[model samples]
Target: MVVKRRFRQVFTSLKEHSRVSYAKIATIGGFCDLDLIVVKATSPDDLPLPDRYVHELLKIFSVSASSFRAFSLSFTRRFGKTHCWRVALKCLVLLHRLLRSLPDDSPFRSEILWTRSNGLLSLYPCHFLDDSSSASEDYTMFIRSYARLLDEVLDCLSIESKEAEEDEVLESLPDKMKEVGRMLEVLPQLQSIIDRVMDCRPTGASTRSFLVQSATKHIIRDSFICYTTFRKEIVMILDNLFQIPYRSSIAAFGIYKKAALQANQLSEFYDWCKFAGLCGSYEYPFIDRIPQIQVYALENFLNGMWQLTESSSSPASLLTSTMESPLSSTEDDSDKQLVIWEKVEENAFPRKLVKDEEEEPLLQWDVVDNGNWEDLLEASIGPCKASRNNLFYHSNGYGNNMGEYGQGEEANGWQMQLYNPYASNPFYQPQT
Candidate 1:
């Protein structure tokens, strides 16, 4: 009888403070679900339950104060107290239904169940997560800095407009024009900062490993999602700014292209990491397939750009040779060999020689003596001797026959005399 009275009092208090109907409270299947909703509600002023109602509810539900307090502190610290309790209750109920859909022995099932029962805010604690708050802060800083730069650029444009009005007849502009020019000069510096921010993504192997080591897979995945969304918002802002006619110069296009490229690479890496996280394996076919997929994407982008431009020159052509080689050489070895052969065919014989059937034979072999074959062979096989006009023999003591022959004026003259095949005498000397 006493227990029934205490439950009645707790229900009445909950009805008064939370505005929940008595019929609904009575129809709740278990004390645990009621307790979860009440705890989540009590953390914020969104549903302001009186202190006495909270105490009675906890006592009736048999929930420990310490557990509720810990969960409230942790959750409020991370997400703040601005959430709507009714919406939070709905989300929790939906999440609980989803969890119940999983198999009984699933790790996620056990982990989420344990977190709920222990009054923990998340399946994985905030302490186990990476410092994503710092990254968010940095992102905010980048946005502010870029916003200021844009403002300055706008100011410069305004000043230039004013100077143009005042300098209609002047050959050169005055100090205001000079000031605007100086302000415009700082635009590149601003663009460089934007480039740095885009390139600052945490896609390195070590950073990913660190995140995996320190946090749950879901935490790391959520962090990546947050980061990617943040960057996407910034990219949208940049795209909007670039749409302004004055800012649509070639240099601005180049900066936007670079930022888009880096963002794409980061997003690809994040997607791969997320897939690896879900599959619980970062090894093997997963890692190996990333480059292939990237190359495929690059090929599509290049092809699309080529179709749009229809020009021989492409923006991608400006990439360093090393980057272009891998992208261009994605074909199989047989295909590559075929390409090489085609090139060889095109370049090897650019001009064809005309046939001359009426032309005489270049040499008459019948006049050659067949008996002198041995002598011809001996002469052809022997080392050549250097002549007097050869600079190499004059510089080096060794003749063209190498060390086998000495370098002397008399020996050279004698060799030259012996070389006169048309002379009647065996030895002949010509005037120096």
Candidate 2:
């Protein structure tokens, strides 16, 4: 009796503490004999939640105080919480894509530029977090910093090699040398921030605004400028050295990657990475190895080009010459052949949220409409000519139900106007 009484008291304690409970609302398709019951369940699958909900749950858990907690966005059959591990995956996928842009022999040839850009687009639906309370505030800061890091890292990568001295000088701060482990930890949070910033309601509009905002933000923009300049410098150096700029040169020149490996920026690195995990709620390991793979592809592309330069004959035209190719008249060796384009088609990663079969892809929305504005207007028109108002009103069977009387003096005396047999619309012509 005592235990039962206690249970009842706790169940009635919503007055003292915020309570969570299940409710069975009205049935879907209720008019039919068979109804679909809409019940709010304890599971995350309640209400077919969008992916953004998961980001909030995972990010809050990153703060020290909230680390043990977990929240989830649900689907009826499957579900997951947004966690730190997602940050790791986001970095890994992006880095992998960036590196793949370099070719095998070129050392900087990337094969997945298109693929990676697509992945970036796929990273949306992660912004609905509201972790302002002290319980989850640290995680929010971590995310903000992680976004700033990505903005800077990309900047360093873009810089030309001629300003290497200046770039190095500017990068002297301890935070500039963070390690790969640290970077991995924060990727998800960065992913969350970016993912959220890029997409809002009405879909495509937010991405443009977000990009513009990022470009204008001083810290983020400066970072891009630094890397872009650094990349330009390396390209110039390589162009002078071997009459070629292999992928390896540009990939190896990153400030963050170099500093991290050197152990000088490990503290800064760890801080950012940890913060990223806190924001994204996931850790990604794959980011660390992507550069190596990209380097290999670039190396192969450059070697192939160099080998051609070494043995090619001035006697034959460059276009017709198959002599420098791995496939040869004299040899049947497979490794000698350069598989430039079609070699990796089957291995590409699948993206999230492909559109429906009949739907046209997202493009600009300023196009001509066939007709019908009155049907689209849900609100009342302040004042328009009676004829215009009559268009929609007369089309409806219960036109008078709209708070305006259609009978008596409101109906102008123009009803006796004779119909023209030669009118444009044949339906309006008088009967023969």
Candidate 3:
């Protein structure tokens, strides 16, 4: 068996050397040799492919996005056709390294993660079997499981890359529910990847290789990334539980159940890592179970909020606000909804219909006599102080004019009051 394995290695090395030599020749003739990239990527040597090849791949990607598909096809084809375990593992490592090297904002990451043609970026199409020896078969199984985990990692990176691109827009118009939905989408993928990492560990009493040890390092690194990201997203979801919206009581309950399950699973997974003596286990933070108090509080909050929505006259319209409100306005009447302020007060912060009328209020306030500066300051800040007394002060407080406007008549445009940050005031006040 030893003789046979040596002979196979010799033959593989010769074949690889021939390909590299031909690729060098192709390069000298001013030709782009993609096969060279694939050969280097799937090299049977235990060590990682050198930095030059990675740079070459990035250069190709820089030319055009479409050119990247060609590289993907070649890399996937090599992985699919190879019978050697070392070559297959090398393919996985090479792909993993490429993903790590790419920037989070790169468009290529999504393409690599989701490309479905010819099973690119997916291992489901692989059917590897090495029956020459038990050790070889063990390596094959490890490769398969590791490949599965890499698929999940790619999935996570893709989601994050897309999110980074849309970050500005999402921040400008923040949506807590939408953000939570995305976190929900990614959290499970991290869990699955960690599970696969566990499965990729060496089988009992199986003789390991330098290649296998190298693979172990990659697995450990990936597990760390997955574990840290998993914990962070879970904690964020829990911390912001009150802000995230739910469609119904069941949805909120579902999140609570998921959080609890993930907490338990994390504890178990960490314990298993400790038992297995996996590197970096000691560095992991202590797992804290989600407190039931939080769950109960969330339950109460959801109950009150949903109850208010149900009792509203236009429950369907509650999702939106009227055009008069600063909330988004839709031109379609069917999509429009009554804002709370409109229901409570008809003339609160009324917007001037004409631009000409809008300028009149500011002009009236600016032309106040410089002689009565104390009266002017009093007039500006006094009515606004009334706003701090009540949480929901919506009445138009301008029944008496302070400047040029006639007495006993309300101001024509919006009403604004001055605030002294130095003075004591309620923690929250209306802004308009």
Candidate 4:
């Protein structure tokens, strides 16, 4: 039996190698490097991938948008053809690492978001199963669950990217309400994925290979990070409700209930993680639950919001108008004029001129024009020399500095200062 299994493994490996070679030969002109990198990175084995190949793929993916496209195509094609669970898991791992390593604003990440939003990214073809043995069956189940979790991860990342973009314009009440609704939608999806993540544990001793153990550890870590983010988002949603004066009390109560329940579930999940030994050493902060008093306050707030909504034609604008600057009102014309005068006074002198005035007392020097300047210039062929004691020099040209006419010590004293209009005003005092 052992001999037959070894022979089958060797034959499978040889076949996979042939297929890879053929692929490389086929794509020799374009994306051969990418194909080679993916093949080596996801080598058909039950061992952890080497860091070197991952680094190489990252280097290629980071090259340009074209390289990102080529790598995605090559990796997808390679994974699609693969029939072994080891290679499929490795491909998922590579993708996870790449997504995690890519910056939030990376062009490639934006590309991923666009593709995912358009339903263009097709990663499901990478699924594979080798269920001839009990151990293989266990791995197959874990891989399916892992694939689902990864899909959720990608979706989560895309949602986060979109949320980041939306946050810039999320100041309005309607936008904030929409954002809260979107976040509420994301929580249920994330909780479902978390359930899947928790289910991907080892069933028996037969499935506890080094590779499985490593993958399980990563899944646990990623799940924990996701849960942490989930908890924070829920808390944020609950807190942001108070900032908006006019909101639906029924919806707010529903959100609070969902958050409180999820909080308990997340706490239990954390306990499970600790028991599983993957996260035993790490300590997660205890998230505070929503208080009953806060819920009552939210109810009253929302009830008031309903009244305001019925009474006001534009409740959101009316609420925000309360926070506007008093000077912005048309009734405060005198205050506005005073503010304008203060601003004009502040701009009376530029910062550089103000600093120069502060550093030195203003002194007036008489401009002594020599009638022998033309005769002296006509006599001298080269640059003229001027005395260093003079603080100013007159240049014949508009833009030409004093240095062009004379390269002497007088050029060193050629301080070009701007005229400060406020300097002549006796009433003007330098701003404190």
Specify the highest-lDDT model's number: 3
Query: Could you give candidate 4's per-residue lDDT for residues 1-432 as a string of tens digits?
Result: 777766656666776767657656655756556777788678776679778877876777666568776776666676566666677778878877887777877766665555545545555332566522335667677677777677777776777777777776765646666666677667766776677676666666524577777777777777767777777777656555433322232444565665666666666766765675654555555655755444433433232212111122242343222222221122422211110101112123112122222212112222213233223222222222333322123333212433343323333233322111122223233333
Q: How many backbone clashes does candidate 4 have?
A: 0
lDDT of each: 0.32, 0.27, 0.55, 0.54
C-alpha TM-scores of all predictions: 0.19, 0.19, 0.56, 0.55
Residue clash pairs of candidate 3:
none
Q: Per-prediction count of colliding residue pairs? A: 0, 73, 0, 0
Q: Report the C-alpha lDDT of model 1 over 1-432, residue by residue, as the tens digit.
A: 667655654553453345334323644755443435444433322332334434443454244434434433433332222122222222232233333333333343333334445554332221221122223333323223322322232333344445566555554745543333333333444434334333334333423333222222322333343344434443433333212222222233344344445555555655655564532444212211223333223332222111111123333432211122212233342211100001112113111112331122211222122333223223322344544222121122234343233344432331211111112212222223
Candidate 4 deviant stretches above 4 angstroms: 1-13, 17-32, 113-127, 131-134, 164-193, 202-207, 242-252, 283-432
Looking at model 1, the pairs that clash are none
Please identify which of the two predictions, 2 or 4, would achieve the higher lDDT against the true structure: 4
lDDT of candidate 2 over 1-432, digit per residue (tens): 667655544443431122112222232323211111111211111122223323432343334332221111111111111222122222322232333332233212111222224343122222312121222333333333444444333332333222333545646433422222123223323333333222211112222232222222322323233333433443333222222122222233233234233222323333453453322223311122223323223333232222222132232332223224221123433223121111112332112121231122111112103222232221122222234213222222213443332332323222111111122122222223
The positional error of residue 388 in candidate 2, measured at the CA in angstroms, is 79
Ranking by lDDT: 3, 4, 1, 2
Model 1: lDDT of residue 168: 55
TM-score of 3: 0.56
Which lDDT value does model 2 have at 184?
29
